[model samples]
Target: MSAMGILSYGLTLCFVLVTFYFLRRTFEEKKPLVFDGYYHPEFKPVADVFRQNLLNGKERGGSFAVFHKGQCVFNMWGGYADNEAVRPWDKSTLTMAFSASKGVAAVIVAKMVDLGYLDYKRPVADYWPEFGQKDKGNITVEMLLSHQAGLPLLDEYLHLRDIVDNPDKVERVLAAQGTVWPAGTDFGYHGVTYGLYVDTLVRKADPKGRDIARFFREEIAGPFELDTFINTPKSEYYRAARLYTQPMWEMLLETLMSTRYFPILGHYILFPDSLLVNVAKAVVEFTKDMSVFNNPDLREVPLTSATVTSTAEGLGKLYGILANGGTAENKVLLNAELVKKLATPLSQGTDSVIKQENSMFGPGTVIMKNPKGQLMFGHSGHGGQVGMADATNKVGFMYITNYISINGLGDDPRYLDLENALYKSLDNHESNIGNQNI
Candidate 1:
């Protein structure tokens, strides 16, 4: 063989070895998955599914909690919080729940409604007159909360800093921009813009000019004594789990393989000018690196659409109040009538940006079905975190993880397994109670 040929063969061999090593490292489990927490014996099935996820390497660090009838029935935490497995996930460990923050924001909105600070049917212009520009005069507060105002992605580019620093400028840009679709005719996932718009609305509607973060902190979190935070504080930073995102290559491969996502991916690729493409671009430009969320500085920024940090227990308890007649330990967090209004669907159809069919939006939350097909309302964060309230059964469910998945919204299989087990356990428990009665 020629010298050049030998050199080429050597290089190829080295490349193969490197790729194999990384692949093995990615898949290999370095340690046993150990969990510590409490669960009712009747809900042992739910606990088993959670353990399976950790043992299978599907979850690196996670916390799952289920609140039934305004009390915690199951709470579990396990694995490592950091990428290197240096920090153990514990009862206090908080993970950023991404868009799950939206659900908490929804709760705050409901409280505002309960307090008579805002009305759903009234025009947003009535509260924030500046938002009336660009043919948005008729958009109601409910329309804005339900994402029916058609302002998913703004026309101009915006940085995270821009959003955090310049409130007036951001509000002006949002208000002056025309809807991509006819206002109230269509709906899209607002993503980043949801927080910006909602924050402004909250400030305008609030007599003391409080933003969503402050409003939530002072009103909801404080009153409920929950650890969830739209703006995580420095003292609590130590307990925050570092987020580890799936590699872009892995995400792309999964997207290509998915039956639901492949067509949407193809459409976005084929038409760069499509709403989906624009929304993706806006999000990518804003977030830049998913790992940046691990930074305390970034996590401290108040973004209600995302960047909520909490343990599963904290979120579970908060939603538990909603699930059980909108009260926390006998204290009224939200009126029963207001809670009923929040559970009612306000908009239903195909989501223009995410391309989800039959997507239903309630006041400020997504209306979805639990595994048992019972009506539930909540928001799924980016990656895999979820927090939801099932009013029919008086159940509040939350699963938080630092190991980010490539799945869309709340479609992560690990989460689904736990949710399925939870409902099944509920069914079994109910059946046992019936037998006892007989």
Candidate 2:
């Protein structure tokens, strides 16, 4: 045989072997993931449904956890945490649960409200006196949480770093803008700013004036005994889930135009004057080193919206508190009355840009209100972390996917909109059962 022909054959043979090796590594699975301690009588059906619907590898990867009566009835995750990891996505891998972390921030703020340190009606200026400047003095804490504070996206100039490490950077950027409309006359989604609101409220209220990351530790996250956290620890670095993005985002230059798939890193851009939210960002900027991100100290930096990582158990536990009447063990996270307040749907208006009708501005959460007024409130993190609980049914749940997004929707190919649809299903099902029981 000619030398060239032989070389070509050899190259093709090597490629085939490499492909087979990876394929075998991916498909060969003797160890079924530890989904639950044991099977549940009720969840056998539910598990079958999730296995058929959410799992089965149709989606890039996804997982779901359901907490019934404060117990995890169904918890399962199966897929690649990273396509390269060769490790199965398990219960321990944490995803950045996007806006869902805002729900967490809301809980922290609500705790302060419960302690009589804050009133939603109070002007933000009351605490941070400088916030009163630039006609912002009248902007209420409640308005900020509800996304009706009249500031939507941050000024375009600032990047994620400006918000994380610099003090007064976010405030200066935002305060420069005029209100979109008079504050509180109409409602819009705060998106990223929601984290800033919650963070600000927590700092103003905490005796030590703790920032966002610490609030997660001292109040909501650490207290819940979940692995979830806004700022990831260097010690826990090995277990942290790595992230990937849709191709469009990776394709763009730093100054490139936005696309449908461009994940607003830190959830909705590096909003400036986002006092609380950026303080919570603990994401590893690059490599395995936790200190790669701007703030290495968990106490100093915060990226409340886009940075926290959590397992299903941790998120479910936090939601369990909201599902229950505001108490997780000895700690009373919020008053029962406040959970009602938190869940109360703000007036629905066109989202500043997303243009969805179903979105309702709640503190940290977007209230899932159906046409019939059946309500289920939970938070969704940036990638595929989803948690929703129907308080009326006393069920709280969490689903975290290391595969953040494939198309515009989460990585799950099962239902393009499964995050919202499943939530609606839980609300509808519970409402029907309630009506029948009554």
Candidate 3:
């Protein structure tokens, strides 16, 4: 009876605390950036949708960019990247683009495939023999791209060190992992596994034996003159923008920061096994500044999971090249057929781990499952970073942000509201409201 009373008291206290927390947040004015509806002549309803999004301010200091025929049609970003309401975020401010870097990394594989240097149908072990450990030798490049390789997280018990400490050793250990399921029988997100695969393949394919990050700069960023990085440098480390999850934005970071690596360490916690995490830590330790994580960190690092940065103008510009079938400004990134190849989703069966079917995947892209309506293909990185091209209409758009939304998973009103806006903006009252967000 005594213990029961204690348990009841604890439960009541927990309930009260949770209720109090929710009530406190209910009135918190997160008003940072409201929407400004800019409309194209034919797509006027998008204006109202944009206005609504800005008013909500769920996406802080984020960008919305559009391109038609490889040219910037509309690109805009506003708000505080730091949320002190002090430093005004600008078009030049870059953020860790999460998995959207996969799209950039995929372009290299497409290039290799185009040159006939890599075969999608061939075994990955053909390229890296050591990768054939366990029953994985038969897994093909297409299997990895489709998330059907049966290896999601590394099989070994893992922590931050195993996840972060060393990549080369991690590769050797991972390459030997036994299949969690039969190859090509499931679709599960690769997460860090994708990075390892891309990095190894890139080093093997490139003349300089470089990582995907360096290959991206040379093949994509340098050629297109875009600003971003996969392997960030210590040189431009001081110009980075600080990102917050929520609520903590108003606090002076120095008070809340750890002595070891404050401020910049938050980004590392958010995006694990990423260049942003490493670079942000280095930048914070060396310069003791939060801005180091915001500048271009481009170098010779290979990351398929993170290390992409760009303005809306840059995104629109790259989409233009993609829209033109991989040629921008007379420089061919890849061929038209290869772009179509990228748009095609490899066969993804049932997944044993995540247990979700990847209805859409094209190399590293996430195409609209029903592209018949919009003919859309592009990629989305965590933290709301997105790049897309409408093949049907030849229009492209890129949305960049420094944060991922945890509340966007289901029927939550906030999630519904944001997704509804995207589809409404797409349909102009043409699509069913129920079908809008998906």
Per-model TM-score, in order, reads 0.91, 0.73, 0.71
Cα deviation of 23, candidate 3, in Å: 6.0
Write down the worst ten-residue block by lDDT for model 2: 282-291
lDDT per residue for candidate 2 within 171-195, as digits (tens), equals 5655565666688787765555556
Count of clashes, each model = 1, 14, 18
What are the per-residue Cα lDDT tens digits for candidate 1 across 294-340?
76767778877787889999999988888998987678999888888
Task: Give Cα-based local distance difference scores for all models.
Answer: 0.83, 0.60, 0.58
lDDT of 3: 0.58
Candidate 3 regions exceeding 4 Å error are 1-48, 157-167, 236-239, 246-302, 348-352, 369-372, 407-438
- Order of candidate numbers by lDDT, starting with the best: 1, 2, 3
lDDT of 1: 0.83
